[model samples]
Target: MDLMALIQQALEASGKLRDLSKKLEDADFKMILADLHSALADAKLESGELKIKLALAQEEIVRLKQVIEQRDKGKPTYNSEGVYTFEGEVGRFCTACWDSDERKMRLTDLASEFRFVGQWECPKCHAGYGAKDA
Candidate 1:
């Protein structure tokens, strides 16, 4: 069973024990029940905290697995033309983002009037590349 379910059960049991202890008239038994209830409450609190940490750790593991899958799918090839492209993709990828960040951000062509005739820019990093760099 999961920690969350166990914690919930412990909470319910503790409540029931508290009610039973209230109805009991014997002093010794009441004191023992109170001690057991306190320990159960403490365990429940720790279990709930552990559940949160476990969830965060599971999320991080999934994120790392996705990064590994992206890397294993295929390595982007360098054309040495100031850009990178995947094996089956037609769009040009940003060299800086791919090499430095392992990202596959596409490069956008700039208008000749605004920049050079064959200038391209990375939308994410804003790195500019010209045809002369090839």
Candidate 2:
């Protein structure tokens, strides 16, 4: 059974045990005692089952996390060059390329081409050619 179901069962058993203890002074206490014992046993078994299920769930979570980390490690990283290439749909473009001779054209100039190359604002134009721009 699932963790939630086991927990609910355990809680119900505990409540029943409390009620049984409250009536321990009555003549029918023997019958209630037997039922409480059975409930206690069931609660213990359910608790063990919950522990096993939690361990399995934790193991799977760790495995999935490792898989994600490995996948991210395999991906390409972009540095100061600002150029990155990926295997499929993912790609990175040099932001400075927009201000260079290679990208003198603008969005308004690319009416026929129907495509914009590099970033919207030229990094070179904003930062200048060297650190002096700062």
Candidate 3:
């Protein structure tokens, strides 16, 4: 069983032990039982705090794993179009943007937007890709 559950069980068991010890006539022996119950209660509280910390750490681990998974999937296949193309993503991406900044900025075909036909450009970095590169 998990440590928190085990601690809870221990606290329950100690409480019952203290209750049963109330039948004894000796005062000093009953005081020791009370002290033992107090320590078990403290242990239960400490276990609860530890359980919260463990949950937060597990969440952090999941977040980091998702980042790693994205990086692995982001490995693009370079087509004959002189640009990087990520899976399930439309259009070509700038190589300089990915290499330098790890950003997947889409490259705009200059033929439709500008005077430079048969050329592409990165909007963020302004890096040009000529038809000769294709």
Candidate 4:
């Protein structure tokens, strides 16, 4: 039986045992009933703990689904120079870093006075590509 069903049955048995014990006058029978009630109480408590853990597991599943959906919506697209654009975002990223390592490393503009001026360089892999002049 499921934990919840077992808990419900145990609680019902405990209540019935209590009612039966109240009508009895023998000390031995009363003591046995008391012990059974205590055991049922422990069983119910353990089942409650399992129920809480089950709820937490369900919540974790929902959170993981949300992460997967977000990743799907934001998956990047790369161009010929290996620059990438994400959905609904303005800036471009380095495709070398993303394609090779799945890292979204942004490209930095090359030093203005350098030979590679007007180009962007990947901070992660040191790859360079010319900027799109828009």
Candidate 5:
């Protein structure tokens, strides 16, 4: 039915064949060989079916992934310029007080640039904003 089931069936058939080989002198050796042959045939058939099922499943997964990518493409995204505009007010205030007040202000004016600063505060009033906290 599935790849795993087919593999298990193949393993079971192999174990039976091993057992039959170990007991070659037994009276039912011929019958065991016949049963092993039948099991091997079934395993082969199951493996073929499993291969087809896996191929179909992989195709479906690819199709679904493409659909998801297309859906995401339609979603809105904030540009670097837009973020700079939105945070301009705070950045400007920090720059103005960078030298006058000394509360440790670390602000980046360029939104396109990425940095790992811990804190940003206004030197004049010590008012700060933590982007990570947000």
Candidate 6:
């Protein structure tokens, strides 16, 4: 049983013992009552410690869930042009790399002198965007 339930039962039993003691004047009964009270006090202390641990565990679970949600939200999504948007941020990503491997292969703009101007190229896969390869 859990510490809380055990502590609660101990408390209830202590109350019943006290009530029963009032009807008897035996010395042995009084000694037993003293021991029961001591044990109940110890149980109460242990219950408090268990409650703190339970609270800490619950807090950790909440923190881990929040971290997972943030990671999933940061994942990129594909646009109509087959490029992935970086968590809604500016930047055209390689859809092939991201969709196939979850790798963020950013596309770099080709220079005007390269004939591939206004196009983006994947640094990792060497794939070209816009106008295709001549």
Give the alpha-carbon lDDT of every model. 0.81, 0.51, 0.81, 0.78, 0.53, 0.79
> How well does candidate 2 score on lDDT at residue 51?
85
lDDT of 3 by residue, 38-115 (tens): 987888888888889989999999988876876987687788877899998898889888888567889887866553
TM-score of 2: 0.37
RMSD score of candidate 6 (Å): 10.3
Candidate 6 ranges with C-alpha deviation above 4 Å: 1-16, 19-25, 74-134
- Give the TM-scores of the predictions, in the order they appear: 0.73, 0.37, 0.51, 0.43, 0.38, 0.41
- Tens-digit lDDT string for candidate 6 (50-93): 88998999999998887676568687876776578876557888
Q: Please give the lDDT score at residue 69 for candidate 2.
A: 63
User: lDDT tens string, model 5, 60-83?
Assistant: 999888767644544222333221
Candidate 6, position 130, lDDT: 64
| TM-score of candidate 5 versus the correct structure, residues matched by position | 0.38
- Which ten residues in a row are the worst by lDDT in model 4? 110-119
Q: Per-residue lDDT of 7-43 in model 1, one digit per residue for the tens?
A: 6787788778778878878889778777877887787
Clashing pairs in 3: none
> At residue 89, what lDDT does model 5 achieve?
29
For every model in order, what is the number of clashing pairs?
0, 0, 0, 0, 0, 0
If candidate 3 were superposed on the true structure by all CA atoms, what would the RMSD be? 6.6
Rank the models by TM-score, top first. 1, 3, 4, 6, 5, 2
Write candidate 2's Cα lDDT for 36-91 as tens digits.
66776677777788889989999999988876764564544444534433344343
Higher-ranked by lDDT: 4 or 5: 4
| Per-residue lDDT value at 109 in model 3 | 71
